[model samples]
Target: MSTDNITKEKFVLTITADSIKSTDPRFDINNLGLGDNYKALDAKFQNASGTIITRDYKKGEHRNTNQTMAKLAFQLFETQIINLPVEVKEKFPVYKENVDSELRYGIYSSVEDFNRYRKTREYMQYHYGDGKVFVIYSWNVFSTILFVQECLKRFGEQGDKFILTYREKDIKESEAETLESNVQKELDKPISEYRNPYSRKLIESKNIIFRGAPGTGKTYLARQIAADIVSDGYYDTYESLSEEQKQQIEFVQFHPSYDYSDFVEGLRPRINDGVMLFDLQDGIFKKFIAKARANYENSLKNPEVIEKETLVQEEIISFLNEVEFGVDQFKTIKGSIFYISSVDDKYIYITIPENNIVNKLSISIDEIKQMLESGQEFKQIKDITRFFGKLFATQEYFYNFPIFKAIRGSRKKNIKPTISTEKLKKYIFIIDEINRGEISKIFGELFFAIDPSYRGRLGEVTTQYSSMNSKVEKFYIPENVYIIGTMNDIDRSVDSFDFAMRRRFRFIEIKADSTTAMLDELSEDNKDSNVLDNDALKDEAMKRMDNLNKAIIGVDGLNENYQIGASYFLKLKTLTFNQLWEDYLRPLLQEYIQGLYNEDEIMTTFANAYGYNETAEGEADEAFESEG
Candidate 1:
């Protein structure tokens, strides 16, 4: 994407998703006068001109991945950090590939070195056209993690959000592929076979609102997008996430009733000793923000500092692992022998516990460490209950607490925060049905904080209930936290997202066809004969959908947003095709034409176009697909 075509007012940052860019002159190695390069060999020799850079080779895949963690970072910067525009996207920075940078930053040592790299003589002679070889170190393209970092840095939620695609290879193998080519392959992959690159890139740069028709799988896609970013493109499906990884995401459904108090922070009534009392509580967004901020801060901490405080915990863990299981070496407060089973970062498993109701019981490592570090004497379950509050006040604590005490009694070790390694983790906040709520009422002063350019301390908001805070502290969303919202184009709420708040987010139209990948789940490739052949059924569904959508668009107000999405056909999982049409699709279409001047005629047109026929009540289930 060139600057001439960009709408400078479109967003606070602009990201260009060029095809994996080898064909572009930006990646051509001999394409000299290129902006810059990285050179480690003659470090200071070329700096006399004051532009050349010397960087060590040690910044390998980790550096690239972080830069490619396009999801973790945002668009590259246009100017100095402080000069970033808050209300509109920054001016596109003028960038070009230069010989100095190509030598310093590109994969090859220099343009000459790249030309000389040919261990695969036959392959190069057959496949490597002189201009086809892509190797440049220009302003990163394909909306790179480097570019996202530069562009989206305006919005600051600091966590390691990696969106990586490059693979490691031995340079000596005479590699035939370039990083741009590898990325191109990924981008070109079909939706059913790959994550949506557009969604990933959009959410990376700023908070996104997905506007589309109902059944577009907008809500589902929104969460999946979050999972993809949180995984740093490692995994896209939300179900694939482990319990620990799932904690990085939070989902909320917005309704007309949702307000600032419910979203930001509010007071809830709590009965304390029989008297009703109001207590200030963190809203879901605020609570999630706290977690994101903790990770962001920990990621910034010096590893050596954390390690210094973690030695004792490390020694205790080593001793526990070294101990043999099934020996009945540890005992509970009742003196019932229990054997150690396993230990992980967070929990300890014990085998053959006195409580025979189950084979083994797991205990928290941090809780034990917390108890140990407190220097508090525990005579009974009450002490554990007092320390951890009501959650651990159960009978399970009675057994587990003593084992922790027994283990610690022998080792005399205390585990601190250092026992848990710090990593930059992405936190995703997803709001389904975002348009249902009145944006201004729900967000209030957050409109200022939500701007991509105003992230961090500069965008801190003294929330509505500031007096409830201990010190009237200001709250800010961290750089690592990303927001995704879904909206139906035809929602009837009187109050909608305010224009100002709309400007704070990047809005993308999620057309019905763009989300047909959802239909892949309905496939029954080798099921019983009674079930319809999935491929044929899918094709039929797609054909009918196209006819109906094409007809709908011909109407005055109806457009792609009014068309049906693949998600509606998901009913084929249990409901038959006719059942889906009559019960679901028909009613939705009727509703669409309810107030039209030719309501009945339009409804008939839609039904005919959709191929609806009550006579063939059991219309053979047709396969369906959506792609853009």
Candidate 2:
């Protein structure tokens, strides 16, 4: 149960030389003590700093010694002191800490000899290669080097020979550490401090699908999970993020006709130079991937250099102009065709009165700019523009001028890598009703790149329409980009999704039990004082819903897989019980039972289960009471 003794180990050192072919074998370098150079070896050792040095000479006898070498292979580990396998790290608690401290682990050898032996592929298989005298340096590499130097000096006397040795020991955890004790300490931590196990699985898998019935907060939770990843851990609820942080997440939906042109890069018709022509345009996923890649590459750069690339005022002005220019169309008093002629610091001048008369009318942009600069509301400009004494006044048309222009900046400049506050800033692409799309047809060649194992630069591919663009030949999904999808499992459309996509995505089911509480939070307060308070209605609604689902699952043609989720009851805050049953629930039940052989009996059973009868009402009350 203790790791005190596990960290300690003993090692022994040995030295030997390779044999040489000779007519008189006794005179070879291998036969050191018997050779004539034995006298010179003694003299060479005498010159060493040691007090006395001598060599023993055995006449006419070849001394052969095969000494044991200590195990120092574990020293090669760089990130940690111990070169333990991943299995060992997972099995032992002491090895799991982010405890990084200075510890000894390395292999040392004669550079010349290692290079010489490296020519042969057989010798290359060895960790340090076949050196003349390989030395593995552990904790006492400095002392070991001095010892080897003296040996090399004496050995050189026999011939032009070199001696080298490397020795190093792998240390795990700390000098004073125990695996059992560490694991016990970790277990002692409160449950709130421990991360969710599923988060780790999601990180490893990279792609996930949240399959359930409609309105289970699948898209909502996807944004939160995506934020958690980029922040390195769950920082707070998604609502707490600053406007800038929220930009890192994206949401999209998929339908039957959605194809590669809408999800990846494709040639699209655009009015370029007054001529309609197809030009390459990046789709939502591709655009997000490009942003993520830029952030990732910028993270590796020096912050000072990024700071030198100043945020000039001209660039900001240009950006503002682009945002305003995007609003090509406008609305007027007659409700049709007004073109935004020009947008300047003072006014948004436009040509108005479509199809009959053409004239210029200007609305002051100062109010909108003030609303942006100071987070204060401005009084609605009354009687702003008048034409023919009609007194035209549309607040929305004048106020909301800068469309698609949401900008947030950090106070500090280049304080962190990846351009100011962003480092490895991730982008999440959430595909709602994922199964409704033709998966293979929509993703095109991106299917290979989207695979979890093949993510990042390793999976880069030349896109199908790459030839259309002069500069770009390849595209890749960065590691910081993630995909989350949601669908109803019972939908017939689910069957049309490609098998290849199914294998790539980790499927996580959102069930009624996990999401029904959302309804209670929504119906917490009654909007109108005249209306009856329905704070407790969610429980009653859920009980009837659960009972209906049970009947649906037990039906002859159906099973638990097709059971309805509690999302159907979310509108109880404003809807009456009678309205929900008579208008919505009854018709939905009828549709579910329409194709069944015993249609009449099935409808009767469903209606009763949904609290249409006295027996069903009693059962619902009993279930709710027991749950409470």
Give the candidate number with the greatest TM-score: 1
lDDT of 1 by residue, 292-364 (tens): 8877655554555456436546656766767786664766666777787777665576775456676565576
The lDDT of model 1 is 0.59
Predicted structure 1: clash tally? 44
Worst 10 residues of 1 by lDDT: 38-47
Off by over 4 Å in 2: 1-201, 214-217, 227-240, 304-421, 528-535, 613-628
User: lDDT of each prediction vs. the true structure?
Assistant: 0.59, 0.51
Task: Residues 1-628, candidate 2: write the lDDT tens digits.
Answer: 2334322322222222232232222222222323211111111122223332222322211121111112211111222323435443323211111124222222324423433423211111112223223323211112222223333333323332222222222333221123223322332222233233444446646789988755456665576566665455654346766677777777788988898888887788966337576656788888888777767555544455454333332333444565444356654333465655666555555655444543554444443343334433323333322311225544444424322122222123343323463344556677888899999888888888898767766688998887543234478876666788888777889877899899889999876566665666545754643333355466567777788888887887676555656666665565654556666777866776678788888878887887764344345444444454
